[model samples]
Target: MGIAEEQSKASAALASSKTTSSSRDSASTAPAQRQAGKIDVLIQGVALFSDGYNIQIIGYMNTVLAKLYPKQMTTQVKTRLSNSILIGDIFGMLLFGLCIDRFGRRVGIILTTLFLVFGIILATASHGATVEGMFWMMVTGRGVAGVGAGGEYTVCTSQALECADSTPEMRRRRGMLVAVSTNAAIISGFVGSSIVSLIVIAAYGGKPSDGIWRICFGIGIILPLAIFFFRMRLNDSEQYRKHAIHSKMPYWLAIKFYWRPLLGCCSAWFLYDFVVYPFNLLAPTLVSGFSKDQSMISSIGWSALVNFFALPGSFIGALLMDRIGRRQTYALGWSIVCDFGFAIGGSMIQLKNIFPLFVVLYALFQTFLSVGPGDCNFLVSSESFPTPLRGHFLGFAAAIGKVGAAIGTTTLSEALASFDNPTKGQQAIFLIGSAISVVGTLCVWFLIPDAPVNLEDEDVRFRNYLEANGYDTKEMGLSASNT
Candidate 1:
């Protein structure tokens, strides 16, 4: 049943559960109570920017690391290097996911950012007497950093969503706000790493050195360091203040009420990342394939340019989010990308030769990838559930997406190796990605629901659901602002 219908059904009992001392009306959806300040936007932006930069920057440095430590960086080692952060992310998501729901967003974001700073410092300084030892140290550091970045995925998203949900206007635009604020921030981080890597390499006169990779890993620390301080000044989102379950949580009751959405959000995220991470992490490698003799600088530059196209796609998705709804925007972007993937992969031979035209086509393909799935992933995942357990569910969904990314990333060399010709392997990727996008489109179409008619609609409905099932709604949402 819809939230509105459920809210209406529970209206009679609302007075019994009203807050004891707070002036804000529990039943009202008024704008005067919440302003959604610039700090909200700032926190979301930097948190995501730091996250994107730290996670994707490692992929940008693979070639440089391979050059510096070829003996130690074998195929198996390469896979471990790429997947370590992803593995770390799953752990962080689960741990902090539950932590934030139990404690508060303020606690989660602070700890996660500290993890980012500590991980980067350890990674940037990674060294040992033996070359293999150094590589091992770097991998260990990145895995820890990945944990912090992974935790940010849920904390930033839910915080930003709540911040934007204070008014009718903001609630309608909540999808856009969360997408633009957090999801789009990731593209910035990802693209920034590509550009920064090229710059760092050029500074060393196009040669690989210990300093180059160290500088690349070390530079990411600044953003998170700043994020840690800013997060401390913040209070938990008002929604969290009202609906958070501080005492013993009704886990089985929540499962009974939310299992369908949990399944849908988790699976949708997995499918999106399965397509997104491979295409994303492999963009430079794929573009480099188009030119037999292009310098490393040129390939990376082109990849940066192609990834830059994601900005426009993010803006487009933000515009469509409230206008058309999250489900429609997500399915629409994937559908178009599905066509592009087939066309580009099927015609790889001819397009690869034309060079400039191929970049444009591939760029347009990446742009749309940003538009739908890119934009909607964070926003949709957050909106799919209620506030009390948003951190838990959202973190779980994101962690699942990382799993898809790890699988997809590992598929890269393995998939390519299975083919005889380079063009055939590349073609296989496009066709596979296209087929996956088709499945992704259908998954969102049926499984995910549209967003709320009001910001607290789900929270209110959740209260009714719990109270009817013998859970205490008032004992929950203990104030965190004071403690």
Candidate 2:
């Protein structure tokens, strides 16, 4: 045969071999791919559970710690203690977000888990002869844990959303999966905290014990530790893997490209936290204001009961998110339901004669929050940006939201202190949160885009943009199969 004919034959053989090899790889990987979706959701849920559990556990510890160290538990000290974890959270969100963007999801998660474990251990083991020493140690530990939790917020949300986006069936139900996991975490936190509180009460006969708070903090570590190995085995999302070869856009460039979506996610989260965290932190106080006859346990129990309302709200919101759209669901929750609930509840809260009305209204307010922004915030944030910058944007948004949370908590505390009438002060805080929610609603309406996005399409678009901008996009293919 001529030289050209021999070359053609060699090319044909090479193509046939490549096709056969691809088939073999696919066959071997099929089972693992089938299992990946479930595993990803499970891991994400566990991480979120740890996050919620830690937050509530610390909240529950506040009163106990105050009673144990009354002299050192001044308003300033309490504020500092509360701010410690939040400050750490701010750092964690930014740090892990960058790490995930650079290193990949699995690494970011493992690192976050380790930080959480370390922080929990430190906080649990904290002890000192001086109140100052003990306080700072605990604060530092909590701060460290906050870092991990903050990272978890970004990494886990991004991972879960990316995984969901890869599976068509899962993608349609993404809102439900993300919201349910998050709401479940919140419920788990409350349940865990309540159980610990009951245990402390039982062990100490309604008195404080040195080990009570320690056990609570220690228990917070169990779930995270149990899942650490699994997290280590977790794979980066296929969407990310397909795009990982492309050089990342500069931070400023990524911002410029995604600023509108970022604004939507950040502003919505800020508003949600601005309303939710304060109400949550002050729940017992709010309940007490309405029903002065309730015991501490009764008050705690009522607070937990109120959280149940959020469960159904989340499911409803998830359904709405899938059926209607993320933007509408968010606006409905924030502007229509939550805004009205706060406005109406705040107005009625001052009317001491209609205490039951106030309680019912307050529960409704929480329920609205649960169904709307509460369940949808993570989903919107994670889905708004492309995979390469998703973590950074989500982390940044979460950090901003935490800022809102810190402000809300501080302002509410001050308002409660400054106003001679506690009821009026709490009512004022509610109005402020409602007003903020209104602004959030406006932001969502105008700033957030309502469109279905395919992750693979996004990656292709991003790669095309990169290629147009003179970046080498030849290294990675345009499509990645779900795994």
Candidate with the greatest lDDT versus the true structure = 1
- Per-residue error at 408 for model 1, in Å? 0.8
- Give one digit per residue, the lDDT tens place, for model 2 in 291-310: 65765566666666665566
Residue-by-residue lDDT tens digits, candidate 1, 282-332: 777788777678666777788888888887899899999989988899899
State the TM-score for model 2.
Answer: 0.87
Top-TM-score candidate index = 1
Q: Residue pairs in steric clash, candidate 1?
A: none
How accurate locally, in lDDT, is each candidate?
0.81, 0.72
Q: Which ranges in model 2 have alpha carbons more than 4 Å from their true place?
A: 1-35, 245-248, 290-294, 342-346, 349-351, 475-483
For model 1, what is the alpha-carbon lDDT of residue 301?
A: 85
* TM-score of every prediction relative to native: 0.92, 0.87
